[model samples]
Target: MVTFEYAPAPESRAVVDIKSSYGLFIGGEFTDPADGASFKSINPANEEVLADIAQAGVTDVDRAVAAARKAFSQTWSKMSGRDRGKYLFRIARIIQERARELAVLESIDNGKPIRESRDVDIPLVAAHFFYYAGWADKLEYAGYGVDPRPHGVAGQIIPWNFPMLMLAWKIAPALATGNTVVLKPAETTPLTALLFAEICQQADLPPGVVNILTGAGETGRLLVEHPDVDKVAFTGSTEVGKAIARSVAGTSKKATLELGGKAANIVFDDAPLDQAVEGIVNGIFFNQGHVCCAGSRLLVQESVYDDVLARLKRRLATLRVGDPLDKNTDVGAINSAEQLTRIRELSEVGEAEGAERWSPECVLPERGFWFAPTVFTGVSQAHRIAREEIFGPVLSVLTFRTPAEAVEKANNTPYGLSAGVWTDKGSRILWMSQQLRAGVVWANTFNKFDPTSPFGGYKESGYGREGGRHGLGAYLVPSERSGR
Candidate 1:
């Protein structure tokens, strides 16, 4: 096992002092941008300046690509699978050891409740590394045939929703399979990804194996279209996902996308009502409902529709909404002013399109971006909220009379990223799981995630899986069988 020591930086209540101007991570070392330009990353919770992150341009991306190419050819790809597993295992341990620090940084940067960052995101990030580490030397047992080879340099762009987890998902498997990577984190939340650069140094990962470029959409576009990048992996909106697909069309580079969703959290009459209610709230209200796989659409059985809605409203009223760093907080501020505007606009469309809107009787913070937990009932199949991805703390309730109707409404959209089913009967759950077209289906659970499970979408939600053995396919090239 690889060994490294971390001296915990003393905790400070002062928020902005922890991070400053961060440079690019190229060849496992932090360096200034080629053009010397930078962009400030702000805390959306209060608009405080978090850090001035490097604004990587085309030249920076080119240098990162060159470094990754060298690493893949000279060092990373040539490592034995057992040796590769050691590095992943080392990273996983380091993450777990520093879980507290990472969790604090995540809450400060992304405006998620500290409880969630500490409990959910950080643990899962570490879990992902552990799960993928075990697979490094066992490729022969995976469904993919023997002698799998690395795709020289992978180009990846991840959204702000789950910065560190997405980074782990992209880096762990790519490294485990002997491929080097060039990654760009979203402009809004670059802090955690930069912290990951420090972890790479602490773990003594080889130079040029993992590079992080911090910038806006333009930087991501350059990485995606660059001629030298061997593969592209993305997690973002469906509109941008389609654009990436079209841009890589007719090219030799491999591409995989994990995009947006409007998942259906179905509630059968026979389901545990209290449990289903909790799942419904969590499915939509978690992360301010910014999750791509968020169960934004609630399909309640017609018989208990009113009772379920009443219980759900009462539960929403009890949730604590406040500062993201507050240990007791349940909901947190919106990620950005821009995201707030999108949520407001889509909500307006829902009302204009004839859905009845309701919000809990809760006072929002006087400053920073905030929105109350909202629900819209009487929503028809044609409303924009029913059709478009709101990406906020909003829910649209539609009732179904039978299992067949639930399936029909659940699969109505262009997205098939994830779905949730709630029922007491094992056979009913199994049958519903098979009929649902999402890449991920949760029976009696909602918004559950693990590093070992493959996570991605089908249809317009986008293609390719990001976790499990399937993720390795995006980073590998198979040699044709000799017999064939």
Candidate 2:
């Protein structure tokens, strides 16, 4: 056997100019937090302090919501759809112009690989704005009738995992549907959203149309509970989603929550082992498994379970894991110390409960938060690792005797966000897609997404969809059920 090593090829951080301190973005401008309280945004890769980020308080949230409502009533709602779409189109173009900058900043603050930030996240972010821009002028044909009104003053909060991409998911649709937004990016990764505030200015977007408030959980609660806000959109944990649901209950506020997931990647004996192995690795390791729809559980048919597991480990060995800026790095640093702690705790529980844990021979960086890509064999259906959403690069291998068993185990979890199928039989793919209780099913692939397809979860995974025409309803008033 032979192995090859490559020289270092890191992306240039010079493309991004980080300021020493920052303020909240409201009414298309930056302002200091009301209480003068702030926190540092640290790079998880090296524990480097990126910048001092202001923490928005209750008054800030109130101001942002007021700004959005003013924009909705005075300026945005009166504008022609085509004109609003022109702004979306302009924003999309500017995103491309500053794509490299956003990618580098995203990697710096969020600790995802530079490759993913540049290629996957940024491109998709632009596509979302472009796709919804077309829909902006064509809402009459959107099946929501000739004049589908928007729920003014959308209040959105996004997670730290995929900062720019999640912002695009929340803001693009809401804006396209004629709504004004007051959004809160996660405290740790608010840099890109602030950068996006600059983009909004670059596009000459109307004042008060888009406001960004960066803060922690209390700030999020204050924004969601703001009486003037008409819609709430959140992407985070299931517990928080439940609380948001409770907060909005009986209120006129329409809410959409995209929460946690424990997706099952099912591989049949008849499937091509080589392709299945590649898919399995991609399923669990993409974005370091921070994806809500990540296929964390591998439900292989009993006949070829051992063979598939061996192939998966061999493939994992080829993965590069360090230096997020390095062009060749496959896996990057975890988003934060807190998230890394959660992953370690869940993995330890998997080991304590008698599962065989294995990791590739990978040396981790000492300064930053890092976790080696892991696989746990002999994982039971009831195991914590199998059931809980371990939002890291960890895979749990479980076996099923029959196709029915595979479907049964896959649908057993509270999360019905997504599932994967790898089988040679076309009929089996069709049947499994129908049987799996998931919002989205990927055949022969995992973690694939596009702006044209709607994505969300069911049950404990939360409700409502994002993307495509269906996603438009989340920001609409009395949204039609049949055509939508």
Model 2, total clashes? 0
Candidate 1 lDDT over 142-184, as tens digits, reads 6566677778899999999889988988988888888899999
Among the numbered candidates, top lDDT falls to: 2
* lDDT for each candidate structure: 0.89, 0.93
Local accuracy of candidate 2 as per-residue lDDT tens digits, 216-282: 9999999999999999999999999999999999998899999999999999999988988888888
lDDT of 2: 0.93
The TM-scores of all predictions, comma-separated, are: 0.96, 0.98
Model 2: colliding residue pairs:
none
Candidate 1: misplaced stretches above 4 Å? 1-17, 482-484
